[model samples]
Target: MIQRIQSLYLTLTGIIGIICGLITDFIPNERIDMILLLVVAILAFISIFCFKNRSAQKNINYLNIIINLLLIGFMVYYLLITPGGDLSPKKGVELIVPVLLIILLAMANKYINKDEKLIKSVDRFR
Candidate 1:
């Protein structure tokens, strides 16, 4: 499974998600954000082991992507409601992590689709 590029992408996504959860403190009531990030990380890790089931892996990635989009929306809402006239560096970092998660998830999905197509083509020869 590690041989596949999607596996590597999923691993990175999981790691980043964990790191973001641990270090993120810019938002009020950060527990919710942290929990969501951890959930995303767990999903990514689970998807990694489902390499034999491309459809399942793709579905998990889709779920992760949707969660990340929600996370991004929450971060944006928080940023807008913040009292400070200027945004803090940590706020920027917090927002960027979810976007990064979405990108990595999308890349993994792309590669998973490619692998599915390859398998289909090979099956056609039999």
Candidate 2:
């Protein structure tokens, strides 16, 4: 599983998610965003081990994408609704993490699909 490119991607995604959650303070005095990001990280970590279950892996990635999307949406909404909330460089940088995670998860899903296709093609020869 560790040898697969998707596994590596998933691992990286999870690590980055965790790091972002721990290091970045996106919202003052609110742990909601941090909690959500950590959840995504944990899901990615667990999905990495489901190499034998392509369907489950794909579904988990889809779910991960949705969570990331929601995270992005929440961030945007918070920024828009809060008074005196400006897109300073520091706060703006925090927004990028979810986008990066979304991209990584999509890439991992693409590779997982490719692997699934390859396995199917090889099995047809039997």
Candidate 3:
């Protein structure tokens, strides 16, 4: 059940991130917000790729974490320092996709780590 949930989460996130990217493509790009979304889309794709190396999923987790942080940082920079600054809080829909991707990446990594640990423990017992 846990493994299924994790896989589902990762898959869902990847799908959503891709959809978000496509949606963002329609919005007019003025201040490079799309850059952060691109980072998110890349990381989301990486999350799916990590499935091949379930053992090295830990390392992939680390990489994904770093990417997520970079995405967040760029988003923050756009919001606080950039000239226009993030769109109106209540009306800002662009922020949703990247932020959702960040949360999904973090959660997916955590789930992968837990799954790895469980498998390792089972191996030890065997």
Candidate 4:
């Protein structure tokens, strides 16, 4: 699995997701965003081991993408509704983390799909 590009992408996604959780202070006394990120990180990490199950890994990546999108939406909503004095441009940059993760997950999915197609093509020769 380590030899596959998707595995590397997935690993990076998990690591960065966790880092985003630790450093981003989107809200005071509330860690919903962090918790959501942690969940995604864990999902990505576990999916990496299932190299033999492309469909399941694809589904997990899809779920991770959706969750990351939802997390982005929720963060934006929270930032918009809260009082202006508490937020700044630097804080808004935290949204980039999810965006990056989305891109990485999409790339990983692309590679996974390629592998699936290759496996299918090979099986057709039997």
RMSD of each: 1.9, 2.1, 4.2, 2.0
What TM-score, over all chains together, does every model reach? 0.91, 0.90, 0.63, 0.89
lDDT sort, best first: 1, 4, 2, 3
Q: Per-residue lDDT tens digits of candidate 3, residues 9-84?
A: 6666667655654665433443354554555556555656567576565565556556656655656555565455
As a whole number from 0 to 100, the lDDT of residue 104 in candidate 4 is 98
Assess the local accuracy of residue 87 in candidate 1 as a C-alpha lDDT between 0 and 100. Answer: 52
Worst 10 residues of 4 by lDDT: 21-30
Q: Model 2, 8-62: lDDT tens per residue?
A: 8899889988887887555432477888889999999989999999999999999
Worst 10 residues of 3 by lDDT: 25-34
* Candidate lDDT values, in order: 0.86, 0.85, 0.59, 0.86
Candidate 1 structure quality by residue, lDDT tens digits, 9-85 = 99999999898788756444487788889999999999999988899999999999999988887878877787664
Q: How many backbone clashes does candidate 1 have?
A: 0
Q: In candidate 3, how many Å is residue 91 off?
A: 6.6
Per-residue error for 56 in candidate 3, Å, reads 3.3
The RMSD (Cα, Å) of candidate 2 is: 2.1
Give the Cα error of residue 35 in candidate 2, in Å. 0.6
A best-first ranking of the candidates according to their TM-score comes to 1, 2, 4, 3
- Deviation of model 4 at 96, angstroms: 0.5
Off by over 4 Å in 1: 26-29, 85-91
